[model samples]
Target: MRELRILRPIAKLEDAAVLDPVVREVHRVVDAVLKPRALEDLLHGVPAGHPMHPALVLVPAGSWIGAAVLDVVPGASRASRTLIGVGVLAAAPAIAAGWADWARSRRQQQRVGVVHAAANESAWVLYTASWLARRAGHDGFGKVLALAGFGLVGFGGYLGGHLGYRQAVGANHADAVVQRFPTGWHELGVLDDLPEEAPVRIEVAGEPLFVLRRGSRVDVLADVSTHLGEPLSDGRIDDPGHRGATITSSLGSVFEVATGEVVHGPATAPAVRFETRINGELIEVRLPRS
Candidate 1:
């Protein structure tokens, strides 16, 4: 069964070093074309706090599946053709969102995504031809094309699932790790450990956090960037904003360490803020939810 799985090539393709530049150039084009933050977010699913491609894909997948059902019915040929046309239309937006996300994913993920997209696009072309053939009264040829297209789409979907679930392209990176911090305050050793206006990574109850101290006032936020779960402590602290000094994540999302509000961000979610109180010699912290 392992040998029979055609979709296994997607995993193998991740190790194909030859295609790296092709993938990089494609991502560069996507980033260059989708320059506006809002436009990029719309395709990336930032508003939904998850990747948007999966949601958009449902339209094409659904329309095709519905058309397949109609294809076998005696009086449903016209309806099937119509549904196929709808699927073709839906594929446009789905592919757009997918390309947008592919730009933001890790290199390895983008490698696998390239083949996955090719397979889907091949299926889309086949399906489009099949629809046109059916409309032109080439019923026998249309059936064969439909079957081929369906097989391609199914294999492509299997690869897409691998990309999403196995490679972890769009997973929420911070939620589980940051939620483990204990309620109420505990000592973080000496207050001197935190440097002024620098984001320092500290482990609190096994949960990683960023500590930024400005004079006597100390601020802490979850160390993970809400955008891609990159380490926020590895980011830089900029000049003061209205709420507090701004910390820029590795992905260029900006957050205020004091209040955890987004000053300018690729992430819609605010950095999780921790309330800090200096108790004499020890620095104490507590989860805001607690």
Candidate 2:
């Protein structure tokens, strides 16, 4: 466990070494080239509960595979090569959308994502070369390029698996509840003891909870930031309204805490709720639970 914990940071560094520069350049180009409308359209399916990348994988893979088949066959038509080229071109936008969504993630996730992007980009380059070789009537060179492109795709796919499964890039890191407290209302202390509009760090059954007192009503939330598991008590609270409040992380990811509504991505689910006893009454409030 100790070694594994240490390895996590090292792994992050390893990923960052390769992904950081690559992603920064990619993001710059993408931000400049893609219009707001097109970018919105690209990200629409992602927040709507569907992964855009998998939908994208189909086009390039299908085209490349088809091209490979045609390359081996005797007298494959010019129309078939053109169709494959078109498929490869169409796949670029889907790839861009997937990368854009991935770029906004935590540093560790971004690291793994960078390698994934590198792999895919290499595949794209190879395929583009293959298309060009075919166009120039260098069938032998084109076949070799197509095969290399396929190899790149396979390598990139492995990296994508690492990013998704090992790094948990697109996965919900917030869903894993590590702190399970006992059921029923727990005593958090006297109501007047808590300072107004200030985050009071309190431990409940060994789990940390950030309690915010607003007059007689106490608003409690998990002291941990769901994004990187940073202490939420360490975060800054801004614009505390009757309806909602925003907890801005040290890294600037804003978690909107309404009375009962959760609005944000990365931390898709609501922070856990804990019932606390204050002033001889059981008050219900939301707090992060393990």
Candidate 3:
């Protein structure tokens, strides 16, 4: 991303705060009318086991690249125009998917997403013009516009990579927890070390984890939400029930204590559940390798 590092400041730009209200208003509208959690889940790719935006982006990106290549080849003007039109058509859904993912990202990630989106939309405008130019027989001008759009798309893609790999937007937050801790059982200290029945946050193998002790059993889960790294220790735990105590994040995700599964909305991925063993007065914990 060195080639695009010049735009790194965009993530810290204070003006991106202007869209905060807009994002909230959109959230309200979606809650009021599209309260169908399934649709949101689909857009976020919960069932698909990953975010959907990345897959959708390939459409416009690939099509535009193909169009650009065609523009340079001899006797491929007509095909170039066709591919450009295809890219324009596919961009709408890809943008929608991106917006869906953005709504679930953190503030910094949202800011980066804004810049990525703006660059992409600007490239789409150029692509549209290129399509029109070719249709009107301005071959040379159309090729120029296509090349410019291609460059802009590359910039946007870099930002998109930053949002995903660097910022962890729409990623399974629990996936990182495994890497921080070892695969085998490790001592969490004696059973008396726990905070009675309350949720106690502690460090295990360099990663934060929360332990909830109830009766003779103990449930250990990652202290951070698997959704956006929201601290699970900051969340409140309800009274234990049939399914287990419901741990709800301040950012609007819920997890079950017994299995660390997300039984509510927002968090598409489940919390990282760790195996716990109590021997006499001592307790041990381990994140499963499988």
Top candidate when judged by lDDT against the true structure: 3
Q: Candidates' TM-scores?
A: 0.86, 0.69, 0.79
TM-score result, candidate 2? 0.69
Q: How far is candidate 2 from the true structure (C-alpha RMSD, Å)?
A: 5.5
**lDDT for each residue of candidate 1 in 21-112, tens digit (9 for 90 to 100):** 89988878888888987787777776675667888999989989898888789988888888888998999989988887787777788888
Off by over 4 Å in 3: 1-35, 132-145, 189-198, 263-268
Task: Report clash pairs, candidate 3.
Answer: none
Per-model CA lDDT versus the true structure: 0.79, 0.63, 0.81
Question: Per-residue CA lDDT of candidate 2, range 20-138, in tens?
Answer: 67667866775565446435434524245444666667787777777777767788847547756876797787677666556556666666666667778887887788778878888
lDDT of 3 by residue, 1-290 (tens): 25467666655643478777755666565456436767766776667666778898898999999987887789999988999999999998787667777766667676677778879999999999999998999989999998999999998998887787777777777777877677788888788767667888888778888888886788989898988888888998898534468899877677899998776646778899999898788888887763
**What is residue 86's positional error in candidate 2, in angstroms?**
5.6
- Say which prediction, candidate 1 or candidate 2, comes out ahead on lDDT: 1
Model 2 poorest 10 in a row by lDDT: 260-269
Report how far residue 157 has shifted in candidate 2, in Å: 1.8
